[model samples]
Target: MSDSNSILFFVLGCIATLALIALIFKHRFFRQQKYLPKRVITPFERKMFLRLKEAFPQYHVLAQVAFSALITSEDYKIRQRFNRKVTDFVLLNASLDVIAIIELDDPSHIGKEQEDAQRDAMLHEAGYRVYRFTQIPTLAQLRKTISG
Candidate 1:
């Protein structure tokens, strides 16, 4: 091939390679991020959340909410320890103040009793009422607990 034609072919090849690189990057990196269908709480927890809302119609029900937002501590260790923790359900009165924290003691919590106790204690120290239920509570039982 002539020198000019050889140089022209080399330039075309470089352009094609760059276009291929750009296409590959677009395919690999430009995908839109999105949320998938993931359950925030278990089926049992869902039932309990609904029941609590029914029991206290005026209260706002929050399920699987972060503990760090609900309560804080002055101590760094305490803050770090519970920063990433989550509560099963939190009930907020009309004023949006936390009225109570309801934790479902499911099978997964069996071996983690110590952690649960510590969590309950932490909430208590924070001046919040924490209620534990092995199974979903009856409307009457829940009302009685809330009232008394």
Candidate 2:
């Protein structure tokens, strides 16, 4: 075969091999796709959510919501920091303003108190009241906070 023809075949073979590798990786990635349930909250969170709704019936209760969704800033750098964190629950008033934030502190969060404080401080700076409950609260207890 002519040198040119041989070179052409080699180029085509290299391209085909690369394409095959790409396809295999793509197939493996697709196979790894997992189907997760919609709810991301722990069992304790669900209980608190119900109580929060009962306490503030007129308010909107949100679970596992991102901080960026409630607060917005024109500064990109400032906004990006909030985008990375999610609150356990957020209580919004009728006009969609954040009335308060509830953070559940289970055993898993014991070692992360500093991290939690930073997040709570940021929320507080944004003029939102934050309530951190170490144990599960009752409907009466939650209601008392609203009235007090």
Candidate 3:
């Protein structure tokens, strides 16, 4: 072949190779992957959830609530501190207003009292009632704690 034709074929070959590589990378990187379903709440959390529901049938009890969903701040850094943290439960009144923030402290929270206190302070600063329970309380106790 002539010099011009040889150069043209070489350019076309380079373009084709690049296109093939891109397609392979796109398929490998962007393809959908399978995700398995798992229980949203643990067995221990489920027990507390049931108790809360029974204690306050008229109110809404939400489990595994995100801090971001509950509160926000104009300062991004201050907000970031609690943005990714998750609360054990949030109780909302009949009007859909958040009444209280509930945290069920298990053995895992033994050494994290300071961290938990800071989190509680942040929520308290936002005008939320924070309740930390080491064990599930009785119906009367729940009513007393939430009401007063």
Candidate 2 — what's its lDDT?
Answer: 0.86
Model 1 lDDT tens row, 1-148: 8999999999999999999999999989986767578878888998998899899998999998898988887889879989888998988988999999999998888889999999988789889999999999899999999757
Q: What is the C-alpha RMSD of each candidate to the true structure, in Å?
A: 2.7, 5.7, 4.8
After TM-score superposition, the amount by which residue 112's alpha carbon in candidate 3 deviates from its true location, in angstroms, is 0.4
Residue-by-residue lDDT tens digits, candidate 3, 15-86: 999999999999999887778788988888888899899999989999999999988999999998998899
lDDT of each: 0.90, 0.86, 0.92
Question: TM-score of every model?
Answer: 0.81, 0.71, 0.76
Question: Alpha-carbon error at 6 in model 2, in Å?
Answer: 25
After superposition, the stretches of candidate 2 with alpha carbons farther than 4 Å from their true spots are 1-35
Please provide, for model 2 over 52-121, each residue's C-alpha lDDT reduced to its tens digit, 9 standing for 90 to 100: 8888899999998888876778999988878889999988889998888889898999889999988988
How many residue pairs clash in each candidate at the backbone level? Answer: 0, 0, 0
Clash pairs (backbone) in predicted model 2: none
In candidate 1, stretches whose alpha carbon ends up further than 4 angstroms from where it belongs are 1-19, 28-37
- Model 3 stretches astray by more than 4 angstroms: 1-34
Query: How well does candidate 2 score on lDDT at residue 146?
Result: 56
